[model samples]
Target: MIKIISMKEEHIPQIYEIEKSCFTIPWSKDAFEKELKENPLAYYIVAESKGNILGYAGMWKIADEGHITNIAVHPDFQHQGVGTLLMQGIIEEAQRNHFIGLTLEVRESNIKAQNLYKKFGFVNEGIRKGYYQDTGENAVIMWKYFKE
Candidate 1:
């Protein structure tokens, strides 16, 4: 049984492990630490099962919008609804905080992630040219609106 819980400092190590497995340019432990310790606008959630982290997601709640920072599921747990659970956690947090909308950027080549976001009502808003430093890939900006 997987449960989505608030991401505490203790969860960073496992979240970092998932980040490394999921991204070409993974965030450093220090970054996660800072977000958990000092970033006032950031909020995160983790999916855990039997004391093991299966995935994690985070966002920055700025004004009336929630900017999704990252979402990742351990490769072994992908396609098993872990990502969806992480997303649900983020969305619930956003709604609870009265966010008017949510936004994220995804690699243009990552169709699976795009599809997942689409399932949650995120629509293509625009493109950010050469947004990824690692690969110089354009990012597809997506948004999900909750307010008029």
Candidate 2:
């Protein structure tokens, strides 16, 4: 019984745990705090089941475009449709806001995530060399445009 809902302050600890579990360079709790409290452009959502958060995703809406900041699901929750639910929530949010498109960057080595984005209509558009300082990994830029 997973449900996608607006991310709130109480979800930070769980979201941070998922971030640490999923990424080599995880964002700090303070960063998430600022984004949730101080950033007007940022919109985030969490997937919860039986009172426990299983995943989270966030984006920053700039003008007519939405830029995905991050998306992660607990390893225990991976492959269980948590990611799909989170992505669906983000996409719906973008469309409701009348965004012309949505974009995100994935680690070049992360084929799974790339495929997930592709499944949601995001197409690889370019690359950012050494985008990840932790491993010097390149990033694959992807975009999904909405019909006008």
Candidate 3:
């Protein structure tokens, strides 16, 4: 059974591998370490089964909002509900922290990811031109507001 749990220092190497496999401009291991060890407002979780990490998600709690920084599932775990589980984990974490809303930016061309966000009640609010530095791709800003 895959379990969603809080990210730890030991999980960095595996999570970094997933990041590299999933994104063109992946974050370095040091960045993950800083987020886990130094960033007070950052929260991250991973999907693990049998000691192997299948996916991970992270966010930053800014004021009353939760800004999703990254969410990725390993290639072998893709389409197996890992992403959905990670999303649920992150949203639950946000709600537990009393966040008023959650926001994330999806690559404009990634309709699959956009649809996944939409399923979780995130709606397109605006666009950010050249949001992705790697490919100069536009981003579709999305937000999910919780009932007060």
| Candidate with the greatest TM-score versus the true structure | 2
Q: Write the per-residue lDDT of candidate 3 for residues 37-105, one digit (tens) a residue.
A: 999999999999999999999999999999999999999989889999999999998898889999999
For all candidates in order, the CA lDDT equals 0.93, 0.94, 0.94
The 10-residue segment with the lowest total lDDT in model 1: 9-18
lDDT of 2 by residue, 37-107 (tens): 99999999999988799999999999999999999999998988889999999999999999999999999
Give the Å error, residue 128, model 2.
0.6
Clashes of each: 0, 0, 0
For model 1, what is the alpha-carbon lDDT of residue 32? 90
lDDT of 1 by residue, 57-137 (tens): 999999999999999999999999999999999988889988899999999999999999999999999999999999999
| Model 1 misplaced regions, further than 4 Å | none
TM-scores, one per candidate: 0.97, 0.98, 0.97
Model 2: what TM-score?
Answer: 0.98
lDDT of 2 at 138: 93
Give candidate 1's error at residue 37 in angstroms: 0.4
